[model samples]
Target: RLLNADDPFRKAYPSESPYFTDMGMNTTIKQVEKVDDQTVRFHLNNIDAAFIQNLAMSFASIQSAEYAAQLLKEGKAGDINQK
Candidate 1:
């Protein structure tokens, strides 16, 4: 899958993908509990170091139920094409 590859897509958007946005992904950051102007706790699924990295790159998505429904409508809920 593309996540395991060194493809341009991986390089361009390694963690949270912008390509998904083009496919109508929701990239909204609704709430950030700011510890300071430069520090905030972001609510995200799959919490990990890479999640922080993805947030720093401005590529994170707050996938609401609506987005999930859209993905299902696209018939690509489980298909991740690497080729």
Candidate 2:
């Protein structure tokens, strides 16, 4: 959910978002949906052959939304580089 622009936390910190920018997954994904507890569906805007390959890169990993929530609750959302 953190990657979703409509999500509250993402909206609160626009500059800090790893999504919604050219350098991020925004260009590859047209939309996203939660399929279930263990599944998510990405709707692509176009057929890009390199999409999966790009996702395989280290920076493409999706961070835990719950962890992000924790950061927000603890007022640490601004520190994006913190592990």
Candidate 3:
């Protein structure tokens, strides 16, 4: 699972800061069940309605996993960072 100090999706919305860093926080995701080949249930923590909206928007390039990984490896993902 990926863990980080900021919610990367926050860039899509207007915000003064990236995400709260006052104290360590986390959001966890687990594949609880698979509804179908294209769908799955995920368990999460510390998420909210805005986060859900961000998910629907498919944050970042919305490309396949492999391509996204390549962008991240090359440090080009920062180009999508709104902050």
**Which is the leading candidate under TM-score?**
2
Estimate, for each residue in 28-58, the C-alpha lDDT of model 3 and write its tens digit: 3333466886776657665555544444542
Residue 38 displacement (Å), model 1: 2.9
Ranking by TM-score: 2, 3, 1
Question: lDDT per residue, candidate 2, 1-83, as tens digits?
Answer: 44565755555554654433545467668877899988888898888787777777654567787887788888876443347
Of candidates 2 and 1, the better by lDDT: 2
* Model 1: how far residue 15 lies from native, Å: 20
Q: In model 3, which residue pairs have backbone atoms overlapping below 3 Å?
A: none
Tell me the lDDT of model 3 at 22: 22
Instruction: Indicate the residue-level lDDT of 37 in model 1.
Output: 53
Instruction: Tell me the TM-score of model 1.
Output: 0.26
lDDT of 1 at 46: 38
Instruction: State which candidate has the highest lDDT.
Output: 2
Question: After superposing candidate 2, which stretches have Cα over 4 Å from the reference?
Answer: 1-25
Supply the global lDDT for candidate 2. 0.65
> For model 3, what is the alpha-carbon lDDT of residue 2?
22
Off by over 4 Å in 1: 1-30, 58-83
Query: Model 1: per-residue lDDT, tens digit, 1-83?
Result: 12334533344433555543453323333344769755557554333444444444433433345655664577554422221
Model 2 TM-score (2 dp): 0.64
> Which 10 successive residues of model 3 have the least lDDT summed?
16-25
